[model samples]
Target: MNRKIYISLAILCVLVLSLQAACFARTPDKLPNVKILATGGTIAGSGATNTTTVGYTAAVTPVDALINNVPELKKIANVSGEQISQIASENMTNEVWLKLAKQVNTLLSQDDVDGIVITHGTDTLEETAYFLNLVVKSEKPVVVVGSMRPPTAMSADGMLNLYRATILAGSREAAGKGVLVMLNDTIHAGRDVTKTITDRVDTFRAPEIGPLGFFTGDKPVFYRAPLRKHTVFTEFDISQLTDLPRVDIVYHYANNTGDVIKALTQAGVKGIVHAGTGNGSIGKVEYPAVEAAQEKGVVIVRSARVGNGIVARNGEANDDKYNFVAGDNLNPQKARILLMLALTKTSNPEDIQRMFWEY
Candidate 1:
């Protein structure tokens, strides 16, 4: 071989290696990146092999495994999974919520991050989703998803939930819609989502409002939009998710005494929800303690404990006399969610009531 040809071949080999390195570059400016923040939900959960009927530890399951199972996702977007925590939904606290929020806030601050997907347990997911819906300040896609079954189930559902959620997070249709809950292939606005099923994969229903859309293949199609002023997209900030608000709920019983409400307030609660027995009607004796709480600045929301039905208002004679906001159809927990989010804006009862109505 000619000596000059040998030098040319060496230079060609160096250029090829350089191109390979550049092609595999991991920079956000160079490659498309979407942040996948994992908070333990059934989607990332693992239950004992013997217990295969859906109950499992949230976040104990891994997103990477789900991604590997759904290889087709590579065609949609680059995915990187970061485990925020692994805990059951009932065990979630304001601290964890704030941590998740911080992760989302940080990702949104990064110009390279195009969107975010959070894997959360379905139990408290609606509330958490609602929190982010009102607080995160980006128009970029922010999606939350969970599973009805654990990874060890006979046919676990986490893999599909994560895939559809990722697709929605990377889709333009989900942007400016605030946080979304993508589950069972349905795209739900965090604000109106409710887990309507006790035990089924097809849970999480929006009876009042239909789903935002459905995730088809590697794409998301929007059919409706949420009509509420939620977090992040709201004109306010709920970084207050960090402060664990002391909110309590009292369920009404036949001849219900007011002790529970008084005791909870005496126990140092900052807010309370009256799970009125019927139509948000409080027992006659229960009014005084609640009234005292209101006077003491303990925010109150009138909710129903019947499991279903709206808490309608009639001149506030029963509840408004005590200065409470009708929780509409929102149960105790959901009402607490609204109160928490509302408190971030103002402590005024009128403002809080208006927030509940509009949101």
Candidate 2:
């Protein structure tokens, strides 16, 4: 009687195992399609030795190698890759930004491509992410991911970061969340996320607003959504443009003479983002140069060098008096991006200031 009971239990276990196998086999068809647009960064970097995280050659690895290195990605999404560029994020240029944005729009417009994961270097990842956030023209999930450590380093984080990014891009929960920057398992809004630490793995953070979500399981778990305008809601369109208007950032310091501002204006930049002191204050020494540039019809946006805080219009500096636009919560680099796009539509300070607040 005992032997017969054991036989029955064994048969039941086999039936359960078979059912699980069948379910697993059918999961691929149900998985979301995710496309990886690889622009080279530290995530694609390689080092001379395992401990050599710094001074490593970046953009050494191709998109296919990155995908194939992580086998787990196959279980969560139907993944494919395309090489966008093979340069470090610091070398990221307006030409590449235009190309990337156009390609992203083209891909997300297709029905087959459900979402996109962009592999970038941490140096300018935030900038690229913010650029796409405004111009992607799709509600589909777009995740920008990178690693501080090279793939060959000890406890290398690239493959895992890429995997989590793939999961995020393919997730239904990640849709309509704006472009996201994922690193160290944290998901941040592209417009708000910035690299806070230079060499650490947990470098990216949204200082004032915090992260949009995190990767908790097979899918990304959300805690909040971005309140700022982004993606499909933005008015900046770049479809016909071959190049963006030249915008430059000028850093402010004690006794600064604003020589750089004058040079930028003479060079014919359409706009300038001043990385001013607290609350976007212009040094008394440099004020005239700023005014002179503004007189030339070069848009001057006052952005603070401080990491977190709003550069309120008419606060420390008299924006109304100077005809200067405040940078809102955007950092200097991001402010430059917005100013570039803003120049495309209107040069009016009021119209551009409204964009500073809205976008």
Candidate 3:
């Protein structure tokens, strides 16, 4: 009887092991992991009262509060937060950009991290998004999110914007789309999206090319793809870059003395983006100073101050003769970004022009 009992116990042990293995195999797959890198904006802003909207302390809210207030996020993915900085987007600098890029690349290299979401200020959100669109080395989704209303204000938009951004980051379809800007239930390519409104939640837009897609009924939908080359396809790599080349923008206006252009040249800027008026034409008064700067070895790129349309190559002015490259639909701020990166690689106008067209 004892021998029989021992054999029975050994058989039960074997059966238990087999059942455990089957249970493990039948379990559902783990959710995608997402990281939220928070750089304060109005989304985290707090005002004196819930009724106050405009005048408030920006970047005062912590990442933990931003994440904890939205409990529904856990149902979608394993989300984590890190506070990179606490400042308004207007104060965003090149140093923060380099630090953020390095951190993003490091996280993307890890096998467990699938995607990333950035909480930024709407003021300079597009600039950061475009900068990341150019330099981030990974194909994983990087969605920059922000809100026009302060978190303390009525009808606050941060909760939903953050929710949509988190969902988009975890989406498999978001891969290889480069950096994305998700706000007002819309998805835009980082390279083209720009803030169109100052005080509205639906501020971001890509005029030449509309949004890449949108989020509806709690799901992300894609109706188009960005035609421009981005992410893994581009040549920018910021891993070894400690400092970016200095570039500035000078806007042209009637009766403008071009004093800013002369001052920028004296300040030893490597490149200048002339925000010319009406199809990127240099006004008669601003022409001599710009020409002088160009002759002083400062690369000048002509970009239109108008909200829409491209600065046509040799349309209003002879860019070839003056060695000035057309902005190619890139706004002045974005042109400054590209020029800073392009100057790092090559100073040749032709090579820089090709970079502008391709990127």
Candidate 4:
């Protein structure tokens, strides 16, 4: 009887060890599949010298080189790369935005693709991120990352940013939170983040709302999520769109004649974003040209030049009186993105106003 009991215990232990081994063997298969879509940016840039951080040629490095340089990414997720565009973000066009958004939708719809990371230039990075935030149809994580320093720089940040972005893209916790802008180990909501500094690694910040989370080593830690409607909840769709409507931004300054706005109107722009001085305030001289533009059936939106604070409707300007839409907290560039998209759905100022409030 004693021998039989010992034999049974040994068999049970063996069974447990086999089960553990099987689980370990399947670990790689269970890892999330993250797709890296590379758009040219400083992250993929190459400098003349290791110490030369600025004046580097961007989009010179191919997507495959970026992935192969960071081998640690393979341990975290099943990683793959596809080059979407090879242009700097400053040169990022509406055409590229449309193509990128379509590709993102297609990839995320697949069962095998779990999440996506986009490498973009910091200049207009927020614009592209915000554009994706409104149009991407998935609840899966989408992270936009860029670097201030080129990859050839001594303290190149692209590899680490890429690694962190991939981790966030694969993280289940990042789903449904909206598109994220990851840089300097900090995670920001695409809708709220903007480039504050011209040449700093920590340039991106969501001034009013702050960051959604941080990458604590390989793990993503969250503090709060954006309350705004985004991603799957947004009404904008770009699947069938070949191009976005023409939109222009007019800056407000002292003693300014709205000649730029008049020119934009004459140029037949579909919409115009007014970067008002304060509180979305229009100057006395500039108001008439703005009114003239609106009279021509041009949709006008008032956004603050001041980075922080909301551009409330009927506060400094009578949005109701002019049938204009307030930009809410969105800056001029982002406001233009929303307006271009909003025009696709409706031309009515009231309808666009509601979109601003919600999205």
TM-score of each: 0.84, 0.92, 0.91, 0.93
**Per-residue accuracy of model 3 over 186-217 as CA lDDT, tens digit each:** 99998888998778777799997899998887
Candidate 1 is scored at a TM of: 0.84
* lDDT tens readout by residue for model 4, 1-359: 99999999999999999999886552778889999999999999999999988788988999999999999988889999999999988899999999999999999999999999999999999999999999999999999999999999998999999999999999889999999999999999999999999888888999978999898878899999989999999989899999999999998888888899989999999899999988999888887888888888899999989999999889998788889899999999999999999999988999999999998
The segments of candidate 2 whose C-alpha lies over 4 angstroms from its true place after superposition are 1-26
RMSD values, in order shown: 8.6, 6.0, 7.0, 3.6
In angstroms, how far off is 343's CA in candidate 2?
0.4
For lDDT, the strongest prediction is 4
Model 3, residue 89: displacement in angstroms? 0.5
Report residue 36 deviation for candidate 2 (angstroms). 0.4
* Model 4 / residue 164 / CA error / Å: 0.8
Query: What is candidate 2's lDDT per residue for 140-252, written digit by digit as tens?
Result: 99999999999999999999999999988987889998999998999999999899988999889988689988877656889999888999999999999899999999988
lDDT accuracy of residue 258 in candidate 4: 80
- Lowest lDDT block of 10, candidate 2: 23-32
Compared with the true structure, all predictions reach lDDT values of 0.77, 0.92, 0.90, 0.93
Q: For candidate 3, give the lDDT.
A: 0.90
* Candidates sorted by lDDT, best first: 4, 2, 3, 1
